[model samples]
Target: MNLYPFQKISFLLVITSTICLLYIPRSLGAEDDEQYLNCSASFQCANIPNIGYPFWGSSRPNYCGFPEFKLNCTGEAPVISFQDKDYRVLDINQSASTLRIARTDYWNNVCPVSPGNTTIEVNHVEYASDVQELLLFYDCPPLNIPLPIQLTSQFNCSINSTANYINYFVTQNLTNSGLTNISSTFGTCNTTVTALVSQSASENLAMNSTKDNLVAVLDSGFGLKWDASNNLCKQCNGTGGQCGYNTSTAEFTCYCKDGPNPSNCAGKKKEIAIGLAVGGAILFGIFIGFYIYSFIQRKKKKLAALAQSKEIPTPLTSKSVATPSTNLSQSQSIPSYPSFTSKSDYDKGSTYFGVQVFSYTELEEATENFNPAKELGDGGFGTVYYGKLQDGRVVAVKRLYENNFKRVEQFMNEVEILTRLEHRNLVKLYGCTSRRSRELLLVYEYIPNGTVADHLHGKRVESGFLSWPVRLSIAIETADALAFLHRNDVIHRDVKTNNILIDNDFCVKVADFGLSRLFPNDVTHVSTAPQGTPGYVDPEYYQCYQLTDKSDVYSFGVVLIELISSLQAVDTNRHRHDINLANMAINKIQNHLVNELVDPLLEFETNHVVRGMATAVAELAFRCLQQERDMRPTMDEVLDGLRAIQNEDLGSEDGQAVVLDIRADDVGLLRNMPPPLSPDSAGTDKLVSSSTPPSSF
Candidate 1:
């Protein structure tokens, strides 16, 4: 203990160094535990590589990833199980957070006749949006001829060729109409399985005619996305620790050198506590210094104020002056209204529509100042332009003409109608922009495929001849949309082929609600001046000046005729007796000459079953086109009739019994009723002479 001052200081430093050195190994051991938890070594499979976190197998331990995402490498390829059903792992992209998986049973077998019928259900994974569904029809009866559907491949199941059935696959989503047609036409067949397939594979199935190609497409599975959120596992990985779930405790445990903990590491707690204590002490010291400085500055300010108060000022006398005249020149211009700069300002006029009010500048930039190259088409209301927003969303912008006073009313009407309606078959309303300089604009979902008219008339370059099944499905979907609108007390006054839009997948989306009117539940009809395409307009409404849901039925009836004949509603080049399609359709159907009226493009001459279905559809159209409103069926009834026709049996070679009555109640009425005069020849005079006008709106 007896030593110099320098010797004593050296002794204290040595003791401190020894204590620090003793704590270093514990820290290093903790780091080693964190590394053990990672298990980041790449797990090489047949072709897949670097399969780590969120997936564990092979050399990776169970504690390295989520329990549900465990992979098994027992087979030639790595496999994963979802809902107890095994799926072969085709590809794993960690950067994209996606997994390509296919059912093991379907992958191994060419014709999954005895499939497990199990659907993969991943808790934290979602099927990709591009996944296409395949409907497998089994045990279908032998056909005399090939049907209109795109038949992929067929197999004979039995030794007797007459007893054997065929299997067909089409690259289209199974709709209610499709199901009904399958049930009706192939009464003996059953849809055994519905499976998800990749978009590329779906396209291959659609384009290629070879049966072997389809087998390969089915083997390559669909894609799925992992739902990984910013959670404890990510945090643990960021802090150089391994993330694992403790199934017994139902909690996330971070693996460290010492042991598993609820957080990243155990030693970090002591380090954080020490840092906080030091920070708090430093903050307290600064607060004291600031208080003392403020006190001194306040004293100095008081001293200066007292010194300034000692000075004084002298008084001055007033002088008389002449006031200027109140009157001024009237040449000054009035101030103009300010332009809108934000959404709040734009929203003042868009409250009724209840949609996003995009700024004019934003849309201008999106459409490159409405370049002519971007113009999609022109209509009665406005010109539509295809625009790509800054956020990478494609939109259809309808720019209305500013001079037409009626255009404003139509614009507001469309906005109001679309805002209140939401359905899969209806086009989505994005937003609109209203400004003094620019034309009134309405934005909508951009449908790449053109209208039904383009496809039917062979005007679209990308589209081919629409098959009979597709045409029937379009009719059903359109009818469904109309029924939905009618149920909501909304009448689509203008129902035409041009308004029925299709998507890339050929799904129907009814658009153009400019003339749509909302009918009240308390009222029987909406009385207004007739406003619709010439041939499609209801004759009763035209003469009596009364609009009703039946008017829409009449218009839709004209569209149905168009679908059947593939002819313009009002073709002047047509024969004088067949000028108006609705009139011609009614006459041909009443006289049981549906074959003459069917579209030659449909190739119905050989297929008797399809020809019969076409005839039934024509009859339905005739009912919808009745002269009297009361005689015509409701949209719901029309939909039911279409569905019934689609579900009708296509008589077998064995001569099975057929049930083909569309509606039981309408049979007698439809048979005995006399034919109404042609809409063109009868004119307004005939309609007024026969019936009384309905009540006004």
Candidate 2:
């Protein structure tokens, strides 16, 4: 294997040149690196500070953001213009890809410089499901027919002249018996304007159709969801890259620390080749070989150091990767629980799935020594208490009822699952107590309003606040969360209205993951004893002891029926043969009695739109309630069906257009079930028997 010195030197020079060329190209791109840093930097406006990617302006360059997401920060609030029309950005929820914006021209005034229909680009952004349209007819003639008292409101306005004209504003798609031949009357107005408001605002306008209320609703603004770079940004950021847009290409670009790439930072990028002239000198080639060997050794040491000191948090797995749980033997005694209130205790304590490890004493002080008045709610696993941490953050603390092995397992299971799952509709877990703590405790972001159950039939039902639109939103949000869980190989064994918490804006926050199971990817279903809220438990799971994603769907079906009917899932006061709400809904839908099942407040009969949507929802619920798990649609399908129904209802051009073509015969064809059980002594025992899963929190 002897080689001449010249030949050996030639091979070394070639190898060194290749290595240097590889490093030089990545390091030479100073302009690309600067753009990456610029895009990575977050900005501050008057109020909405720390605004980051997908939105750039002022201090940030064009390459830092998408063209449509540019912001003008010189105003009182962040302003984003679409099609030359300016909108005041009230709020931005980056996680949800949603923003609250109000029309600048019509913020506080009924009249604007130029009245036109509100336009939005469907490709860039779209209105939220809960948003509705309102039509404002201005400068109308003295009407021969009076405006509907319920659907329209008339007010006097003086525009350009001393003469006064009657102005009317009507809620679109909410036509009732009170309004007839309204289009011709609206055509008589000189100026017509269309505006969008939230569904709750539209409902309030329907209740008291006044000029002042309409003005207030218009001032509040509506929610819009941006879709231009949501998926692209996720792909870029997932690979340790800064998300940006190439203005020249008009396409998304991923900016790595090294340089710019098309998809992600780690993706193989285009390389540039450099040619080197051969050098016959032996000393130069020998020096290059030594440099290459030293560089390799240094890189190995650097990687080894990083592996030991750095802990990368992953959303797909448990925190055992960071601080593994100790396996205790039956013969071993319980370790001494420490008072984790001091800084030293915290420094020594282990993290729970990359989340904070709270102290028993600190949580006790936060909840006022576990006062009964501070209690928010209770579940099968534990009771939740409303608390304010020392740092002044309002939180809901769940205290496990027992310190048994099963309770500990559930506590660890929840912390592992919740810390890995992130969604706007799912409840946020702030932290939890260690396994050695006196009692298991979980802290979550506090939701002030109440559960969906409270609004439907519990304490808040008398207020009649949960509108049909809000209920539909709740169902869609819950289904979305469940679908996300399924995608992540998890199942929400407990799905019920009581677990669906609502905030002031009627946004859903699904809680209670104690009964959830992290399903194995290799298996179709997990075999375990059925455990969940009685009325919401899947009948097939109870019978076969096989838990699948469809179990969540079955539970959600009961939730949907409850939303439309406003009936409790399990009502002993109801007919014994129809004790279960699912059973009652099936009997009603099968017998073509959906009108009887729907709540009167939803205007199921008066409002054709409501009738169409409710009937369609009832049919979907029937499909979800199929006894065979194989027949029921997946949670993803359920979410899509609900969204389609909502979009159709909101997309109605005319107020009278039916959202769906569902008929009585169509309902009959969807499912064929046995007749309702007779209300006899035998049936009563069967309805409320031991075989029925016991009802729990």
lDDT of 2 by residue, 339-418 (tens): 54766387236577888888888899998798766666654556777677889898878776551223345568878878
> Lowest lDDT 10-mer window, candidate 2?
685-694
Instruction: State TM-scores per candidate.
Output: 0.45, 0.45
Model 1, CA-based lDDT: 0.67
> Model 1, 1-697: lDDT tens per residue?
6965455545655564565444433443344554354564657765687787678877777766666678888778889987668889999998678989888877745465464443543345777767766656555666442345445666434322245567665555444344335423543454345677888888788778466776687788888887533266666667766666554433456765545666675445555456556655655565565567667767766765775687532122144332364234557787999875665465633545677767677778876798765666665456667677778898877776542222344556767778878888888888876433245777888876667877666345133556666777789889999999999998888788877887756678887764367789999887654556668889777544578989989999998888888887877687755778887888788898888888887777886667878878888899899888899999999999988877775533456645433333332333344433332232211211101110100
- What C-alpha lDDT, on a 0 to 100 scale, does residue 111 get in candidate 1? 61
- Cα RMSD to the true fold for all candidates: 23.3, 25.5
| Candidate 2: Cα lDDT at 174 | 44
Cα deviation of 39, candidate 2, in Å:
66
